[model samples]
Structure formats: structure tokens, C-alpha cells
Target: MFALRRLSTVALSGARCKHSLPDLPYAYEALEPIISRDIMTLHHQKHHATYVNNLNATEEKLSQAISKCDVSTAISLEPALRFNGGGHLNHTIFWETLSPKCTEASKDLMVAITESFGSFDAMKELLSAAAVGVQGSGWAWLGYDPKIKRLRIAQCANQDPLEATTGLKPLFGIDVWEHAYYLQYKNVRADYVKAIFEVTNWEAVSKRYSKAAC
Candidate 1:
């Protein structure tokens, strides 16, 4: 329920703060039958933790660059900052937006989804297409457009954060990276994307929508 600390914000600060991997809310096996224990274990312990570590390192380098007035060096580091920072932010939200229990979307969220895409199922179809269509490692997201007061489906390449890249407040996201599903789902990305909904934490997504829509 906490907000994610974006890499941009962290880099702009005068002081450097070490980023740590947020612990999974449930055990590795909690999401099983949908996402395997081995996948979750590696995803959290190895992949996500790597991002956190790299983000911390990137921020340190950025701080040094800024202190030394090395604007060129700082600019050169932006890609690393975006990649690692986005990875941390994205995965943190991803973990929170999934659960082992079955839950339904909140009425308000469903209404919004219907209003935006004609129906909830239609929205899912669109989002699924976007997720599966990602050319390589990336994510598909259901996000809220604050200015338009509507929900939107979008995709980002690599670890590009949706908000940072597209100005959309993320409601829910599907990580389409090979590391997310390759071990169990193999090259069947669509199947993995579909099964993810089985563990989708709609309630958590609803809470995010409520805040973003406000």
C-alpha cells in the first residue's frame, strides 16, 4: 500500500539513499499452481534483488557526478538509472498486485473499466494483446490517466516505468519478461499472461485506481 520510490526522484535528491528489495507479501509457494515456487523464488531473490542492488549503485554514481558537476557523466548514467530504477519500481508493484487468493475487481474499478473499454472482458482482451505483443522484455499495464479521468492500457519496453515514460498512473501491470515465466511456461508467453490473471490481486489494483483516480 506504500508508494514506490521512483529512480528519477532518488537521483534528483541531494542525498543518496540505498534501495532495498521489498520482501514478497506471501511465501514463494503461495502463488503456485499459477506461478511456480521456483519461478517466484528466483524472480524475487535473484532478478528483483539485482535491480535493487544496481539501482543503489547507480544512485551512488549519480550523486558523485552531481557533486563533481560532471553533467555529462550524469547524463550518460540516465539509461542505467532508468533501467534499474524502473525494474525496482515495476517489480515492487508487480509483487503487490498479485495474490494467492481469489478476488474480484471493486465495483468502482469495474465501472471505470467498462466505461473505458465497453466492458471488463474487453479491457482484459486489450491488455492481454498489449502484454503478449511486447517485442521483447517489457510489461503491459492498466493505468489511470488523471487528466482524462479514464483508465488506459499501455505497454513499455524493457524496464521503462509506465508513469515515467507515459505519464500514466499504474493500476495493474503484467510483467512479460522471459525471466518471469520462461522456467515454467517456456516460450508460451500468452499462456503465462493468461494464467497470471488467476492470481491477480484485483482488490489491490482497485485501491491503486482509487488513489490514482482521485
Candidate 2:
């Protein structure tokens, strides 16, 4: 698993700080055929990078506002903080939850999926439908509901972080934003959603599930 730096920590620190874009675990060409090299390069280097840069800038301003006790300025910065922070967090998890090659779910995860959604295929079906059904740019998530010890499928519009928006620990996320698929699949979002499964990093997701379950 990648060492994910949770963006919420940086946002709440109230100190001048910078959040750098994370390097991809695999080369941009790794997930090729399913997700093209061009798309991956642009998505990671361009799109996700923008979020990291904006987040660092926003946090710097937030720190200054807090230090001055400028209540109004601090309040005004909340939307920026949430937007950029969510973008950083969502993309960080999205990148890690994907792999160049297909992988299988851990045994424990398979059992949990059976209990939660009847079968592993059923979970994929639900998650795919949710991802394709998104109205616009957003993410479809398979999240762990700790209170019930169950897996749940949920969608978050735009860059909204799944955990913050739905109180579910994000185990796997499918980014349905245009930037994620437009270059490779054109306007056919469903095709992109369907193809992403070929490279789904189930091992990483299973680890996340285990942690969230605990």
C-alpha cells in the first residue's frame, strides 16, 4: 500500500504547509489498453497535480487567516478547503486502488462481500451501476460501514470524499469524472467504468477493508 497522506490532516493543521502530488505506484503506461498512457499521464500529472497545488495554496491562506483570528476570512475559505482537500484525498485513494494487472480479493474480503452483497460479482455489478449512474463528475465507492460491519456502495458528486460525505470508510473508489475517462473512452462513460475492473487492485482494497473493519 502507498503511504497516503490524508489531506484532512494538512487542512486542519493551521500551519503553513505544502502537500505534494504523490508519485504513481506504477508507470503511466502500466494500466495501458484499459486506461491509455496519455490519459493516465494527464490525469495524474495534470489533473491531480492541480488539486495538490491548489490545496497547498489554500491551506497556506487558511493558516494565515487563523493566525490573525480573521473569523470571516477563515469561514470564507471553507469551501476551497473542502473542494481541494477532497480532490487530493479522493485521487490519492483512486490511484492506489487500481493496479496494472488484475487481482483477487482476499478470502476474508470475499466472505464479507458474500455477506454484504450476496457475492463478489454482485458487489461489482452494484458498484459499476452506481459509477455509471453518476449524473456528472464524481466517484462511485465500495465503502465499509464499520458500525454494521458491512460493505456499502455509495456515490459522491464532484470531488467529495466518500468518508466525509457518507460516513463510510472508502475501500475502493471508481472515479467517473470526465477527465478520468474522456480521453480513452470518449463520451461512453459506461465503457470506461466496465473496463476499469480489468485493472482493479483487489489486494489493496482488501487491505483497506481489513483496516476499516477493525
Q: Please tell me which predicted candidate would have the highest lDDT against the true structure.
A: 1
Task: Per model, state how many residue pairs clash.
Answer: 0, 0
> What's the distance in Å from true for residue 47, model 1?
0.5
Query: Would you give me the overall lDDT of model 2?
Result: 0.90
- TM-score per candidate: 0.93, 0.92
Once fitted onto the true fold, the runs of candidate 1 whose alpha carbons sit more than 4 angstroms away are 1-14
Show model 2 residue runs off by greater than 4 Å.
1-17
lDDT tens digits, residue span 1-214, model 2:
1222334444456345579999999999999999999999999999999999999888888776775568999899988888889999999998998999989999999999999999888999999999999997899999999889899999999899888878999999999999999987999999999999999999999999999998
In model 1, the worst 10-residue window by lDDT is 1-10
Tens digits of lDDT, candidate 1, 160-190 = 9999999999999999999999999999999
* CA lDDT, every model vs. true structure: 0.93, 0.90
Query: Superposing all C-alpha atoms, what RMSD in Å does each candidate have to the true structure?
Result: 6.5, 6.8
